[model samples]
Target: MKWRTLENTAKIFPATSGKKDERVFRFACVLKEGIRAELLQEALNKTLEEFPMFLCVLRKGLFWNYLEESKLRPIVREEYRTPCSAIYVRDQKNLLFEVTYYKTRINFETYHALTDGTGALNFLKMLVYQYLMLAYPEYVKGPVSKLGITSSTEEDMVEDGFSKYYGSGEIKEEIPRFKSYQFPYHRREHGRMKLIEGLVSSEKLLQKAREHNTTVTVLLTSVYLCAIAKDMSIRQKKKPVSLMIPVNLRNIFPSDSMRNFFGWIDIGYDFATRSNELEDVIAYTSDFFKRELTLKRIGARMDNLIQFEKNPLIRIVPLELKYIFMQLGAKFISVGENTAVFSNIGKINLPDDCESYLDYFEFYTTTPTMELCMCTFQEHMTLSFTSAFVTNRVEENFFSILKELNLDVRMIVSGDSRAGQEHFPDLSKETATHDFWYRLFTFSCLAVMVISNILNYLLIPEMFWSRYVMGGMASAWIITSVGYRKRRNLLKNAVWQLVLIGIGLYLWDYATGFYGWSLNIGLPCLILSCLAAITAIIIFFRLNSADYMIYMMITCLAGFLPLILNIAGIVQFKALAVICAGISFLTLAALCLFQWPAVKNELIKKFHV
Candidate 1:
């Protein structure tokens, strides 16, 4: 069967609103040390020159999308910068060797759009081991047979031993169930990770989970649940905190993409609210979530989404106006939505070759952006733990949980990533470009936003109640004020903005269908409006040094903003659903460009006078 291009209007709702689709994420881990950065850089230069495949990203309808920026491959880095470095940045690493370092820490980052937590973990373990030999002089190094790399050291390691999972497998087609709707794409607030990267086997972790009378995910989830509860209790004395564990629909569906093939299903009970017995909490959560993970439920969810997207129209209201209502509903009600997500990618496999030389993997879960994500992966038997948290308190709780489990963390290490650690360093010392032309470009962006908002306010009617209008206005307002001092209260205001947009989108759908308006017009606007809104917030936060709190507020805002887009009249344009997600991604990319004022200012400085 030919892989079809995702429709401009994707079949969202059931399959994960394309907003959370598998195709959009990517994960990469760096390994190597002792060698000068230049050596690794040279190796990367050779590798890319040798094999184009060394740098690629996944493409729509295609399994792999390599880096379009080939000369300098854009690597998705997951940098661990805490316990010393706290900033995490994602970018392209020109060379594979730069990722591995015996002198410094290794770096790893994942693209949620590419693969789920599990899939990325497999890749990370292998990537790390490959780096180990190349960096340590004792591990293994020969002519880089894989992608292309030449190292000075030589060690015996089987490349096949590194990877533990399959690229291709029996695919079963099953549908997943979840409340579906349409909204803009968003980037969550992501924080630093206190990572514990080790070597543990899947078999051991599963056995442990079973021994604890829990599923692997449940057992891992228990760690997070316990950690979060502890974090909350230690902090502001909040009640039981809720957690969301992303259940891959593909796991139950059989026929799902290995990439972006999952949905975040809630999986936490208030730790403080949990039963006195850990068994009760574990059993209840395991059982409850276990049922939610079935193919039947997934199918029903997808089926309902299909129906919702395909239903008949209500030809009474205008398209734009209808969306306003749905957007409103989403904002007022949904966006401040689910509390937090705690996901687990069960024991993962490194490629067979690197297995013997490798350790386990680590990953983090973020929604919009999470308060903290307590994730663990078992390689052989030792459970490697990681806690992605914005603050020390949240991290401490995660560590405390391991102690409670009677598993003492054996070691702690830190890494230096120009991307993550040097995130927003002082601008005065940096030197980039400060061209007059670039200065003009900066002004041009703000100018364009100003003009766009002005045009929107002028062209859009005041009386019309559509989510697009609300979202656009709100988004515009955010961007306009983005360069100013931060506004914490705006978090709630932003929440309301998304809420209104959700309501407006829902209502506007009815108006468009009832009035016999073209869905093409209604949907593109609706979906793209979500695109814009999510983008605006992401940009706002990204410019502010990747602030986790703001990201949390905005992602939560975007997550539930689309429920009503399919209400009555709107047709589910899955292709457009994908479009919304893609555009939102673009928005995020744009924001990432401006992540650091010094870097941005450098460019302007160079191009300016």
Candidate 2:
């Protein structure tokens, strides 16, 4: 299997992501006509052939979580699930992103650890272009070139920007921190979220920004700060209304990597001390942008973040324990310091010929409290608010402020629990039926024992035939339990079955007669069989030796036990036992001689304490 380490900023997402905070973002492109699932599936298949990095699955190592190459392929289906629902389930080997369609919209939702908004948008654009080429061959004829995308090599798509740009520079002074004000509203039950999208004229918004002599991002951010302040009470007004804004690092550094190449800055306004009017807020925001958006400030922060990944002590800590510390830091340091998140993805660009098939683009992200995301098409400027609060007052206040500026704002609202309730399958009913049948089978086995015992008591008292039935039932349960416990890992399952069955054979041999066949031949032969199975697995999967070394080590250690018993004169057989021990010793020696570093590294990570 091929694998790569998660970048510096991506390490925390897998740890801190949960039901309330899914850490998933969505990008959708609405076309002029309704969607066709077949053509869209073909488009996805073609898109994945070029972008293999998006097809990998998230796997956990001893020290870190990584992206491992998987054989699982994504299927494009009609949209039935809520937007930005969870896509990365721990221990499951599914793809990290999903593509679905709803009427005229093509939705692409991805796990944050895979890529950021910029990387995701590029992939989405290519997917749309491919679908267009296939759907309408007349208007958009392709010569195998990606339309509306900057040319980039496949290697550049997976490059780690943080590793490329970080250096051993002097650390700057830390920025001052404060506890930001949060919304004093009740949260919805069962992880429900509300999405509000407001569409307005892009040219009008740009003109409005020009009148204020600032960029569109700073102007909207000022309006958002004012919107958040509208809900603050007298006591809540003392703390600053802070928002965490994600900045694309590719703008500062020279790279075309499609992975997560982004950094964030926290911009806040003190409503209690400063003026709360729009013009005043705009002035303060424009100044903050000028000061924090410099290369010196961004570089200092980027270096500080990457420094933690380089620590020797931190690298040695196990992934499970590291996640605990990560979760704590997120709750106390990250969430406590920022009231909300805002990401401005700027614009969605396409070729002039391809733009005729598209209506507009929409973007949003999942959040525990709230998040506001902005993006623009040719004439449409979309400001989407994703909130977990029970009220929509923040979104209401946001667009209302824009409307006050004489901008024609159009609003579309969707809820988590309402959109797809009818589409969810009743999994609980199926589980209940399965449990009922399993319990009934066990009860029938007990009843058969009772009936057999009564028949023996009435007919033959000397022979105990019912005991055979009882033993058979016990063996059935043991087998089922073993199979159920290790179903996920096939290599481990094979080893465990060999051990358990070998012990059972020995017990049966002792009970029937003391022929010593279990120890002399049966156990040794089974050990050799396990060794062969492990060898087959490695060859079949074309796997790295380090990936399966732990299994190999266990089988080798078990192989010596039969020979040790024979040396102690406990087993009479010698040839098979000697062969098994000799083969195990030779394999271990070869591993230590040729692949020692990888084997040793695996051991250190597993037993780091």
Candidate 3:
């Protein structure tokens, strides 16, 4: 039940998260056989015991949101959702990580709030090791001991390394900041992040880098910059195509914490300022790496970050307000300050026994514009390019550079193959036909309403005729609501629509007559029906119940309105009101009883009173 404030660097993730940028990272382990659900779940349970930090849920504190150990358990399932989808702590309060298997691949996705790639990789390693031991006991060696799981103590695993190293007030020197060149933002089609992976021989790539007198990361950064430069307009050519390189701090600061302990260095090449030669880009990147990768520079930057967090004014602000400022800060820091991120986890070295059971390791980071993650296993090195932009010109140019280097590259694209196609087949005819029917139906509804209203006004002047018009309008609304196409969460959207219609119907009935039916039956029935339907969907679909708790709570609150109306003598039906109140109270009480610890923890974190 212990709670810990988020690490200094980890605070930005929740603030910056949005529909397109989820702030989640994916680390997939391709196993030799299909993942056994039972074994994986068991393995995750066992792994959680050792790395308890990863089992925590995020909660809001007065000044900042913190992580607290969750009472719920992590479950394993088949992979169904898209990779790197948003992991809302409110929804999945138990764990900040997800484990799913697709065929032979075990996908381990972690929210950046909980841990960074290094921490997640350690957790995944242990999970896979345990799974292998359970599934193929004959092939696996010793019990998790030989898996190279970090021997860091639980205290160390949860340690705020940034604060540990830089919290002291002694380092007061102000570090100068510079504005880097920005890449022009392109709107991604449908806001779907696309991943394109290229597998090349590790030896060939290393040899090519050595010939240029640079390391793999520097060489790859150079090539990536070259690719970006190709698409730069004459106006943009003056700006530096900066690449943000994430450096793992564990190597420098010597902390065993699995929490976020990383720093980034911006490396750039200005085509308009200097030669766009590959060698020049490499040398420039190498020089920057040599200077910025040093502990002195990184430590100074960490100190500067800590100073901002330690500001007295910042410390007193409420969490909600802090979230707004942090979001604006994250956005301001990102826009025009850098081009893209290049995170290289380097070659993954597994124990000899476990190596044969694994195929390859893949890493993906959610990016605002574009991100490239590099990892190598055995002879093949894979460079994964995840972009928010639809076009793959940068990726194409990157691989084309490798092809020129005489390296045999194999490309694999996730999602649609027509993503980067120049000539998209015309769908106007199909869309026109669909729109035509929709417009026709809409026009028909409007015409009926107008004509019926006119005829009723003209012929039935003595009679109340607006009811017919109201009926027509209701019919039109119902048709429109039902006919609308929802691409995602269709059932949830439909349920909401039904609830809205139910409310409208009750209001209309109340306006027509204080018929005891709407209040006596309709309102209570709608409340109970929505509750029942949503509960059934959650249970049947095996969705996370925490995700729908807010909706259920709102329904319960709405249920009370009927009882208040009854007390006010607006609705004379006492029986229905009592029934509605009973149901709402009982449901809410049940939630509190079952999830008291989580609820209490959430309140403590959110209100901090």
Q: Which candidate's TM-score is highest?
A: 2
- Full-model lDDT, candidate 2: 0.84
The worst-scoring run of ten residues by lDDT in candidate 3 lies at: 422-431
RMSD of 2: 7.1
TM-scores for all candidates: the values are 0.45, 0.77, 0.71
- Model 2, 256-339: lDDT tens per residue? 888898998899789999998999999999999998887778887888888888888998898989999999988876766888
Candidate 3 lDDT over residue span 532-555, tens digit each: 876786788775444455456667
Q: Is candidate 1 or candidate 2 better by lDDT?
A: 2
Q: How far in Å is the alpha carbon of 495 misplaced in model 1? A: 32
Q: How many backbone clashes does candidate 3 have?
A: 1
Give the per-residue lDDT of model 1 (tens digit) for 382-445. 3333333334444455556655665545433221112233321222343334345545655666
Ranking by lDDT: 2, 3, 1
Off by over 4 Å in 2: 143-150, 168-170, 414-417, 420-609
CA deviation > 4 Å runs, candidate 3: 89-94, 167-185, 414-609
